[model samples]
Target: MAALYTTRSLSAYADLLDHAGILAARPEAAAEATTTISFATDDSREVQPGTLFVCKGAAFKREYLVNALAAGAVAYVSEVDYEIDEELGRHVPCLIVSDIRATLALIADALYDHPSGRVSVCAFTGTKGKTTSVYYLRSMLAEHAKEHGLPAPAFLTGVEYDDGVEQGESLLTTPESFVLERRIAHAAEAGCAHLVMEASSQAMKFKRTLGVEFAVGAFTNFGEDHISPIEHPTLEDYFESKLLLFENCHTAVVNLDTDVAERVLAVAQRAPLVERVLTYSLEREDADVTVQEFERTDGGIRALVRTPRFTRWLLVPSPAAFNLSNALGAITCAEALGMSANAIEFGLASARVPGRMELYPTESGRVLGVVDYAHNGMSLEALLNDLRAAYPDRELAVVFGATGGKGVDRRETMGEAAGKLADRIVITEDDPGPEDPAVICDAIAAAVSAQGHQAWQIVLDRSEAIETAVRETAGQAVIVVTGKGNDPFMLRHGVREPYEPDGDQLKRALAEWDAAN
Candidate 1:
């Protein structure tokens, strides 16, 4: 069946669909006679049959029309006031909408059976930890409440999956808006009590997160990166764009650790619907929920969680104090939803976000290794500090650098961080998307040199960098691998290919080293 939209219903938003224009047909007949009472879309894959197909914008590819039509699209919506070729539209019906993108939204709103009113949704935005914090929130909610014994952690993510489950490879940080809502509706049908999602800076800036209200919103943290002509042009605009999430939500969950947290909180205050403000932090004593006693461990930090109702030792899995902030954000969210101490402890123990602060053990005496997604300076410094505290007497070997095609600002930032934090910094290629690996390492070296670091080397081969870092340390050392946590591919020239830079590979290498002993 085609995606259905009644002419009577669409007539109400005719001007909305066409950017101040009304729907019209070729015959110039009465709106009733010419208007598509209903037709299936042929060009857009997102548009179902009997739904309106947008035929505006020259950049619109022919493949979109062909695939959508083949899938049983029937009606067409266009701004060109022209017809698709006969082969493309022999059976497809057509009409003219004033604007194509707006029409797409209008039609999609009707097709999901109008699901917005039925769900309790939320959106999370930041440069890092969006996915991890969201997964933690969803999993916590799923375990606490048994709403009909069917309320499970349900939602879409920016990751890839092998079992069609939530945990898998991440192809994108945020998908298209059309697909995002559809996936949320599925979770709603599954009786999800909450929709926790990572709202990227790009998503909000492009208006991709519009047409929804987040019951809860958040800002994780920020740094000087993602500033580009294609991305955010400046740090202020980048921060301001992400601040929109706080406004769109009813209750805001904030991280006082964020440098821009105060400004973000101001945005939340402006929302007429915002009812409450919840906060979390590792350093701030005044936070609603805070870590009273923070102690670093071989794997991660063990923070004594303190809220008005409960105080318990919370153990984080990943080995970074940056994770301290991430875990604090999640705990604040869990508590605002009225989660118990038992539930909070349980969820914290069960919480394991892919590639955030993942750690693995090795056979060598005093050998600890961590793999993390800390591709920037703020995060790298935090992880290094935690490692230094955990093994104050030991050396810290660092491996990390910039991703290809990403801003070089991250390159300089990470370099500065490692120079200040690590005893031995071996700069390695991280994804190098389309840019040369040597180029990224040079940027890192320049930054490290400016800091007057003594022991820093540039290794374009990522695996070699990890291996060399591992080999350089003898008695006791912590090796930290930044920029690709649990990532299976190395993106070169915009295409992701198979590459594994595993910190746990040290486990096998350690065995070989121990054999010689």
Candidate 2:
């Protein structure tokens, strides 16, 4: 039997409704006459004369249907019920379901031959640490498989890896169901024994992970995030969406340090299907995975991380407690996957996430600088808190912004945190797509001002802002540039322009500052 659906393939979409517990009857036509269909997404644009063309959220548009039909799409899976009418799609064949999100999930399972059922998978979710945690688990599992001489473990992450198993760069935290299932199928075919992924709350809110199985899941932490028309409506919604991961996973590794950790843990355990649970924490001493001791050196922080199963001191250059929690979460999940101590240590020592709390030295001053992808309030607060604790006596300057369309909730919260915690604030542009830059800065400024923050400035040109923030920092002060960690592009007015002078730029500017002095 062929693995993928062909033009003559049929639908299990009605069966999906019943599974979701909707009060809809199965369409009799779906079970009997097999509708030979061609469903084309970006993965395979080439199709036979009769293919179902699907245009999905965030990346999808009507133009895709036009192009796909030109390439021979006889059907369409669209969000809108109205017709895009042409001889090809007008009356040819299209399945217009009430919810395209739900339908896409059902089709994804069918297309991938339901790979989730055959594989044990773990999903890590949160405002921070999802990417790092996924990598940590993947590395440990891969190393374990290597030492045992077993089939290599495979993974899907923000940064991808494949030993000819065809791992690709994942643009989204969680991809669309169609692409995601296809990728998982690729892993299974390549002899993957296990899978780990970074599951985003966006995946749940948008129904991206619908019908996906989760053998293990973790919640790193949560705070104000993704509050836009295209994202979640409020903090309540954000929490609700993140709650989905624990609900879906059979076993959960939760962060005991999170403000709502206890409530989330209770909810997950209360779920009828959840069988096992674990907790990692920096605060709560009773956590299954806890940081027994945290020590900072001239190099970086080193500490003994412990669990009931084992204990070891991990030395790393990553600069935040947030990163520590991320490492703990990954280690906890990896240990659960039956990895050995050696494998866990190797993965922890080697793991590095590009945009999360990456630090460097400056030539001009005795001060250290940091660049982080701390876009939301939860992440920003953690980063700021860590910075303060790391250099208690040194003054702190923050150069950051809230991305456009995420609204003032995160910006306001972040600003409030900065005013309370930071000595200097430089509000700058961060992917202000389709929204005025100054307008976004104003919201952040309002939050800071409401709390009576001092010595704050606005420089919209990002490089100029970083330079200004760096230059203004006197002796023994830290310059922290954040918001767009390792992202290559700066979005503005719906166009992705180049932004090369990021973290490196801060270092180079610091060099110039020293040169001038």
Candidate 3:
């Protein structure tokens, strides 16, 4: 379906470019052309009659512009001029701008009636806990609103999007500026007063989140990830991109437990955009929000928190201790946004992140299944070590694989961690993208063997590997299925095929094992 738009003439829209701080230098004849833009899109396939096609990205080519025009685009927005057939150029106006990304953001904001101005936009950024924090803030806001008889908050994270009505899988951690503006617009129309989201390093690096001024910018711990030729080239570059969120936010909330907290705080404080800074921590007693005590209960983690406004015990219904820090960071943001203590407590108690430390137990007594999206080595090791400590009696077993073309270090580290902790292991295929799955599994298998662990098997098919892991240790150990959790598909050779969810696959495996036994 087409988005709502208000038509603006080429000359009129060009006139407003100065107000938007965009330099417009087009031929007078082209500017005077009677073209009207009723829609704006960055994708050529979405171009329609009177649409302004935004030619952005390093991959933009003349063919995209030609196709957009052929699809009835009245104008093209690009940072550089493109050659077109002389006759075709006369009908389609090419609007040259200094920065197409920033221009597209402004245009989308205008077309969407400036939705961000109407909504309280909150954003969380970090390497580890962006998605989890997004879920926490959304749930807290929902609880606060429900208590006051207000509308539910909207959300957009890497895992899913709640557009004030329905929830669906997300295309990106942070979508393109145009798509983001449209979703925020829909959120506003649905009476959502708050919009919580994740500000990914990639999105911030490309200025995809340029227009909105976040009401609260929250940060979790930063670590080494997303470094590649196409992504951030260095850890410093990645951290700098994550810092971009603070420059456009009104208030800042940071986790004091981060190793580089002082540096991050200094950066945020020095930025003229930040008016307030709040800190949360599990270790520091003097932070703005501090966890007084935390313990691993049978069901989950329970922590007592202290803040100037209130002191409360938060029951995080998850076994991961790292989640206590995530909750505190989110609770600080919620407090900064004026959420009551009751709402915070209720939200933390009930909010659950799908596929992050999601637990399942089989009908048989001794086989427990845990599914988590701990794809990288750091997270995998942390989860495994924590579970080992928490469940001393159960033998630790893991089913995991490394993603191809990325996380090259993860294969070795994951294998080493499993070898040191897990009693048994199963190495299998993950998203191998353009690389072969067998090769990816072989790397992990070699790593595990190098660590002098022999109780491991390599299964190229992930479902079979999961089933084998369950069947072999049905009544002896707790099996953790890692890498792919609730993800819907497996990426192989640039193609994604439908995949069985971890919970569903575990249930099927358990049934099969029970029947055979």
Candidate 4:
């Protein structure tokens, strides 16, 4: 007898559905005929022959179906039936379901051979530390695997995606279910033991992470973010969406350091699928993972981790206390993953996240330039506080700008924080999309002046503002530039205009400041 193999056919896909309407030119195509789909995609251009194209999203149009069919899509999965032109009606087929988002996830899982079950999926979700915690887990897990002669862990984060073999730009925090499952399948085929990812609130709210089970789900602090007409309409919705990740994970590693910790834990405990909830804290003593002692060093911040199992020292190369909490969350997740303490300690010592608190020192040692991704009010306040704590003797000079068309209240909050905390302020452009940069700066400056800030400048050009901040601030001053972290361009009038990075501009500004002095 020949070897038997299992493959999902059109009939099997129909079996997974409780109710659906099938529209096809050929009735047999919609019936159980044993035809296997080779690929699936939501993008019309990505469709190929024998593809199951998913027509989704509230903004979807009929043109997408025509394009998908033109690109050789054999079938479509959508919430509603798409009308076809009389000439092409006979050749196109669509499977209409009530819930396209959930249907897409279930179908993608079946198509990808259920890869999430093959690897340890560890996810991090929160308002602030999701990106940083994702990076931390990848570094720690990779080091642990390398030391033990195992394959590196894979990650899908806001900054980038590491497939355990190579890194690539990440277009979204969490990709669509089809793309995400396919990437996980790639990792499983590459012999990866773990897949670490950031579960964005938007992804959770929209069911983009549906059908994927996580072994470990970590929460690293939460705040009010992504709240707008196009994003989450309110804070409660945002928080509830983040809690969705716990429902798909076996273990929950939560940070007990942020606001509303009790409420967050209460919600996570209600997740039916979560078996264990582990807590980590930088200040609270009762957490499962707690920091016993810490101090700022020339290289970074050194700390001691105390847990029920062991006490280990961690030398995290970032001075922010919030990042320490992020590291602790990663460490707790690593412990859940059975990584050794040595590997965790070593990884934390060497890991560095680009654009997150990137620091540059001047030759005179009196002026320090810092580039960070502190866009919102809460993050900005935390960053400025950390900088103030780090350099008690140095005056704090800040350059920042609010994003346009969204986060409308951030300008006032950020300006208030800077006015109270900063000695000198420079308001500049940060992705002022479709809004005048000077107008945004004026809002921030008005708030600063209201708070009695004496010295301020509004420079529309980001580079010029940075140079002015660097040149005007003299000895023992910390010149901090917030927002625009690692972004290659600025958004204006719905277009991404090419611009130099904050680090490059800072280097040039510092060089000029040096040359003039």
What lDDT score belongs to each candidate, Candidate 1 first? 0.68, 0.74, 0.83, 0.83
Q: Report how far residue 329 has shifted in candidate 4, in Å.
A: 1.0
Ranking by lDDT: 3, 4, 2, 1
> RMSD in Å for candidate 3, one decimal?
2.4
Candidate achieving higher TM-score, 2 or 4: 4
- Each candidate's root-mean-square deviation in Å? 4.0, 3.6, 2.4, 3.3
Clash pairs, candidate 4, are none
Question: Could you tell which candidate, 2 or 3, scores higher by TM-score?
Answer: 3
TM-score of each: 0.85, 0.87, 0.93, 0.93
What is candidate 4's local distance difference test score?
0.83
User: Where does candidate 2 have its weakest 10-residue lDDT segment?
Assistant: 23-32
Scanning candidate 1 in windows of ten residues, the lowest lDDT window is 1-10
Task: Indicate the TM-score of model 4.
Answer: 0.93
Model 4, residue 486: C-alpha shift (Å): 1.9
Put down candidate 3 lDDT per residue, 1-517, tens digits, no spaces.
Answer: 3445667777665665657667567646555467778888888998888888888888888888888889988777777877574847464567678877788777877777678888999999988777778888888999999998988999998878987756799879898998898888878888898999999999888888888879899878887777777688888998999999987889999888888899899988887788999999989998999989888886789888998799877898888887888888889999999999999999878898888888776666566678888877667877888888777888888999988887677788788778888889999998889888888888888888887899999988889999888778735567899887789899888788899887789877866776676
Can you tell me which runs of candidate 1 are displaced by over 4 Å?
Answer: 1-48, 54-59, 66-71, 76-109, 114-116, 145-148, 160-168, 297-300
Model 2 Cα lDDT, one tens digit per residue, 328-403: 8888887677677888887667666676677767664477888887777777777889899988988889999878
For model 3 the local lDDT of residue 446 reads: 85
